[model samples]
Target: MTTDPLSATFAALADPTRRAMLARLAEGEATVNELAEPFSISLQAISRHVKVLEQAGLITRSRDAQRRPCTLRLAPLDDAVDWLEEHRQVLEGRLDRLEVHLRTIQQKNQEHDQ
Candidate 1:
Protein backbone atom coordinates (compact mmCIF):
# COMPACT_ATOMS: atom_id res chain seq x y z
CA MET A 1 0.00 0.00 0.00
CA THR A 2 1.05 3.55 -0.67
CA THR A 3 1.36 6.16 2.08
CA ASP A 4 3.13 9.39 2.86
CA PRO A 5 6.59 8.87 4.26
CA LEU A 6 5.59 10.11 7.71
CA SER A 7 2.49 7.93 7.75
CA ALA A 8 4.56 4.96 6.64
CA THR A 9 7.06 5.65 9.43
CA PHE A 10 4.43 5.94 12.16
CA ALA A 11 2.68 2.87 10.83
CA ALA A 12 5.93 0.94 10.85
CA LEU A 13 6.51 2.04 14.44
CA ALA A 14 3.01 0.99 15.54
CA ASP A 15 4.21 -2.52 16.29
CA PRO A 16 5.99 -3.33 19.57
CA THR A 17 8.29 -5.80 17.80
CA ARG A 18 9.37 -3.14 15.35
CA ARG A 19 9.91 -0.68 18.17
CA ALA A 20 12.03 -3.21 19.99
CA MET A 21 13.98 -3.83 16.83
CA LEU A 22 14.58 -0.12 16.46
CA ALA A 23 15.69 0.11 20.09
CA ARG A 24 18.14 -2.71 19.50
CA LEU A 25 19.48 -1.06 16.39
CA ALA A 26 19.98 2.20 18.30
CA GLU A 27 22.81 0.48 20.16
CA GLY A 28 24.39 0.07 16.71
CA GLU A 29 23.83 -2.61 14.06
CA ALA A 30 23.00 -6.30 14.31
CA THR A 31 22.05 -9.18 12.12
CA VAL A 32 18.48 -10.50 12.11
CA ASN A 33 19.53 -13.43 14.27
CA GLU A 34 21.12 -11.16 16.88
CA LEU A 35 18.06 -8.89 16.86
CA ALA A 36 15.83 -11.89 17.27
CA GLU A 37 17.63 -13.03 20.43
CA PRO A 38 15.71 -10.87 22.95
CA PHE A 39 12.26 -11.92 21.83
CA SER A 40 10.51 -15.28 22.13
CA ILE A 41 9.28 -15.08 18.55
CA SER A 42 10.99 -16.83 15.65
CA LEU A 43 13.71 -15.27 13.53
CA GLN A 44 11.28 -15.06 10.61
CA ALA A 45 9.06 -12.82 12.69
CA ILE A 46 11.94 -10.51 13.42
CA SER A 47 12.93 -10.50 9.76
CA ARG A 48 9.42 -9.42 8.77
CA HIS A 49 9.54 -6.64 11.36
CA VAL A 50 12.88 -5.58 9.97
CA LYS A 51 11.36 -5.48 6.52
CA VAL A 52 8.74 -3.05 7.76
CA LEU A 53 11.44 -0.85 9.23
CA GLU A 54 13.36 -1.06 5.98
CA GLN A 55 10.29 -0.02 4.02
CA ALA A 56 9.85 2.92 6.39
CA GLY A 57 13.46 3.95 5.83
CA LEU A 58 14.01 3.88 9.58
CA ILE A 59 16.68 1.23 9.23
CA THR A 60 19.14 0.11 6.64
CA ARG A 61 20.33 -3.42 6.08
CA SER A 62 23.70 -4.08 4.54
CA ARG A 63 25.14 -7.35 3.39
CA ASP A 64 28.03 -8.43 5.57
CA ALA A 65 29.20 -11.80 4.33
CA GLN A 66 26.13 -14.01 4.40
CA ARG A 67 24.26 -11.80 6.92
CA ARG A 68 22.33 -8.63 6.36
CA PRO A 69 22.95 -6.42 9.37
CA CYS A 70 20.30 -3.85 10.10
CA THR A 71 21.49 -0.38 11.09
CA LEU A 72 19.49 2.52 12.46
CA ARG A 73 19.04 5.24 9.87
CA LEU A 74 16.74 7.55 11.91
CA ALA A 75 16.46 10.30 9.29
CA PRO A 76 12.81 9.52 8.59
CA LEU A 77 11.94 9.67 12.29
CA ASP A 78 12.69 13.38 12.31
CA ASP A 79 9.59 13.95 10.19
CA ALA A 80 7.44 12.25 12.79
CA VAL A 81 9.03 14.26 15.58
CA ASP A 82 8.65 17.48 13.65
CA TRP A 83 4.99 16.73 13.01
CA LEU A 84 4.34 16.04 16.71
CA GLU A 85 6.22 19.16 17.79
CA GLU A 86 4.23 21.36 15.44
CA HIS A 87 0.95 20.15 16.96
CA ARG A 88 2.39 20.44 20.45
CA GLN A 89 3.19 24.10 19.92
CA VAL A 90 -0.31 24.74 18.64
CA LEU A 91 -1.88 22.97 21.62
CA GLU A 92 0.36 24.85 24.04
CA GLY A 93 -0.66 28.15 22.52
CA ARG A 94 -4.33 27.25 22.99
CA LEU A 95 -3.65 26.26 26.59
CA ASP A 96 -1.88 29.55 27.25
CA ARG A 97 -4.89 31.46 25.93
CA LEU A 98 -7.20 29.42 28.13
CA GLU A 99 -5.01 30.11 31.18
CA VAL A 100 -5.17 33.86 30.50
CA HIS A 101 -8.92 33.74 30.12
CA LEU A 102 -9.33 31.83 33.35
CA ARG A 103 -7.09 34.28 35.19
CA THR A 104 -9.12 37.24 33.89
CA ILE A 105 -12.36 35.60 35.01
CA GLN A 106 -10.91 34.82 38.45
CA GLN A 107 -9.74 38.44 38.87
CA LYS A 108 -13.20 39.74 37.94
CA ASN A 109 -14.87 37.38 40.40
CA GLN A 110 -12.52 38.54 43.19
CA GLU A 111 -13.15 42.24 42.40
CA HIS A 112 -16.97 41.80 42.40
CA ASP A 113 -16.85 39.96 45.75
CA GLN A 114 -15.61 43.11 47.56
Candidate 2:
Protein backbone atom coordinates (compact mmCIF):
# COMPACT_ATOMS: atom_id res chain seq x y z
CA MET A 1 0.00 0.00 0.00
CA THR A 2 1.03 3.59 -0.62
CA THR A 3 1.06 6.37 1.96
CA ASP A 4 2.07 9.97 2.29
CA PRO A 5 4.76 11.23 4.64
CA LEU A 6 2.11 12.40 7.11
CA SER A 7 0.39 9.03 7.10
CA ALA A 8 3.70 7.24 7.44
CA THR A 9 4.66 9.46 10.34
CA PHE A 10 1.32 8.88 12.11
CA ALA A 11 1.57 5.14 11.53
CA ALA A 12 5.04 5.07 13.02
CA LEU A 13 3.82 7.05 16.02
CA ALA A 14 0.81 4.79 16.56
CA ASP A 15 2.94 2.37 18.56
CA PRO A 16 3.56 3.27 22.21
CA THR A 17 6.98 1.61 22.18
CA ARG A 18 8.09 3.74 19.27
CA ARG A 19 6.76 6.86 20.99
CA ALA A 20 8.64 6.02 24.18
CA MET A 21 11.81 5.48 22.21
CA LEU A 22 11.38 8.87 20.61
CA ALA A 23 10.81 10.40 24.02
CA ARG A 24 14.03 8.88 25.28
CA LEU A 25 15.93 10.10 22.23
CA ALA A 26 14.55 13.57 22.90
CA GLU A 27 16.95 13.87 25.83
CA GLY A 28 19.94 12.54 23.86
CA GLU A 29 21.06 9.90 21.45
CA ALA A 30 21.00 6.30 22.75
CA THR A 31 22.17 2.96 21.47
CA VAL A 32 19.68 0.17 20.73
CA ASN A 33 20.52 -1.53 24.02
CA GLU A 34 20.11 1.70 25.95
CA LEU A 35 16.68 2.20 24.41
CA ALA A 36 15.68 -1.36 25.26
CA GLU A 37 16.79 -1.21 28.88
CA PRO A 38 13.46 0.01 30.26
CA PHE A 39 11.40 -2.48 28.29
CA SER A 40 10.99 -6.23 28.72
CA ILE A 41 11.28 -6.76 24.97
CA SER A 42 14.33 -8.20 23.25
CA LEU A 43 17.08 -6.07 21.73
CA GLN A 44 16.01 -7.31 18.32
CA ALA A 45 12.51 -6.02 18.93
CA ILE A 46 13.86 -2.63 19.93
CA SER A 47 15.95 -2.60 16.80
CA ARG A 48 12.86 -3.18 14.71
CA HIS A 49 11.14 -0.27 16.42
CA VAL A 50 14.16 1.88 15.75
CA LYS A 51 13.99 0.88 12.11
CA VAL A 52 10.41 2.04 11.89
CA LEU A 53 11.29 5.37 13.46
CA GLU A 54 14.18 5.71 11.08
CA GLN A 55 12.01 4.98 8.05
CA ALA A 56 9.47 7.55 9.15
CA GLY A 57 12.17 10.23 9.29
CA LEU A 58 11.57 10.62 13.00
CA ILE A 59 15.01 9.45 14.04
CA THR A 60 18.47 8.89 12.71
CA ARG A 61 21.04 6.33 13.78
CA SER A 62 24.67 7.33 13.71
CA ARG A 63 27.77 5.25 14.10
CA ASP A 64 29.66 5.85 17.34
CA ALA A 65 32.49 3.33 17.38
CA GLN A 66 30.72 -0.05 17.34
CA ARG A 67 27.48 1.40 18.70
CA ARG A 68 24.75 3.07 16.67
CA PRO A 69 23.08 5.82 18.64
CA CYS A 70 19.63 6.95 17.62
CA THR A 71 18.85 10.64 17.57
CA LEU A 72 15.43 12.25 17.22
CA ARG A 73 14.75 14.27 14.04
CA LEU A 74 12.43 17.18 14.70
CA ALA A 75 11.67 18.17 11.09
CA PRO A 76 8.94 15.59 10.54
CA LEU A 77 7.40 16.45 13.91
CA ASP A 78 7.53 20.14 13.07
CA ASP A 79 5.68 19.43 9.85
CA ALA A 80 3.04 17.49 11.74
CA VAL A 81 2.67 20.33 14.22
CA ASP A 82 2.28 22.83 11.38
CA TRP A 83 -0.46 20.71 9.82
CA LEU A 84 -2.29 20.43 13.14
CA GLU A 85 -1.98 24.13 13.85
CA GLU A 86 -3.42 25.02 10.44
CA HIS A 87 -6.46 22.82 11.07
CA ARG A 88 -6.84 24.25 14.56
CA GLN A 89 -6.97 27.76 13.17
CA VAL A 90 -9.72 26.69 10.76
CA LEU A 91 -11.78 25.25 13.63
CA GLU A 92 -11.22 28.35 15.74
CA GLY A 93 -12.43 30.57 12.92
CA ARG A 94 -15.56 28.46 12.50
CA LEU A 95 -16.25 28.57 16.22
CA ASP A 96 -15.77 32.31 16.30
CA ARG A 97 -18.25 32.73 13.47
CA LEU A 98 -20.74 30.51 15.28
CA GLU A 99 -20.38 32.56 18.42
CA VAL A 100 -21.11 35.78 16.53
CA HIS A 101 -24.17 34.25 14.87
CA LEU A 102 -25.51 33.05 18.24
CA ARG A 103 -25.06 36.50 19.74
CA THR A 104 -26.96 38.05 16.84
CA ILE A 105 -29.84 35.65 17.35
CA GLN A 106 -29.90 36.40 21.09
CA GLN A 107 -29.98 40.12 20.40
CA LYS A 108 -32.84 39.71 17.92
CA ASN A 109 -34.80 37.69 20.43
CA GLN A 110 -34.26 40.27 23.14
CA GLU A 111 -35.47 43.06 20.82
CA HIS A 112 -38.54 41.05 19.88
CA ASP A 113 -39.37 40.47 23.56
CA GLN A 114 -39.04 44.21 24.33
Best of the candidates, TM-score: 1
Task: Kindly state the number of residue pairs that clash in model 2.
Answer: 0
Tens-place lDDT per residue, model 1, 1-114, is: 788899989999999989988998899999989999999998788878888899999999899789888899878988899999999999999999999999999999999998
lDDT to native, each model: 0.91, 0.92
Off by over 4 Å in 1: none
Error in Å for residue 68 of model 1: 0.8
Off by over 4 Å in 2: 112-114
Candidate 1 is scored at a TM of 0.88
User: After superposition on all CA atoms, how large is the RMSD of candidate 2?
Assistant: 1.9
Each candidate's number of clashing pairs is 0, 0
Q: Tens digits of per-residue lDDT for model 2 on 1-114?
A: 777888878889999999999999999999888999999998889889998899899999889789888899999999888998999999999999999999999999999999
Evaluated at residue 86, the lDDT of candidate 2 is 100
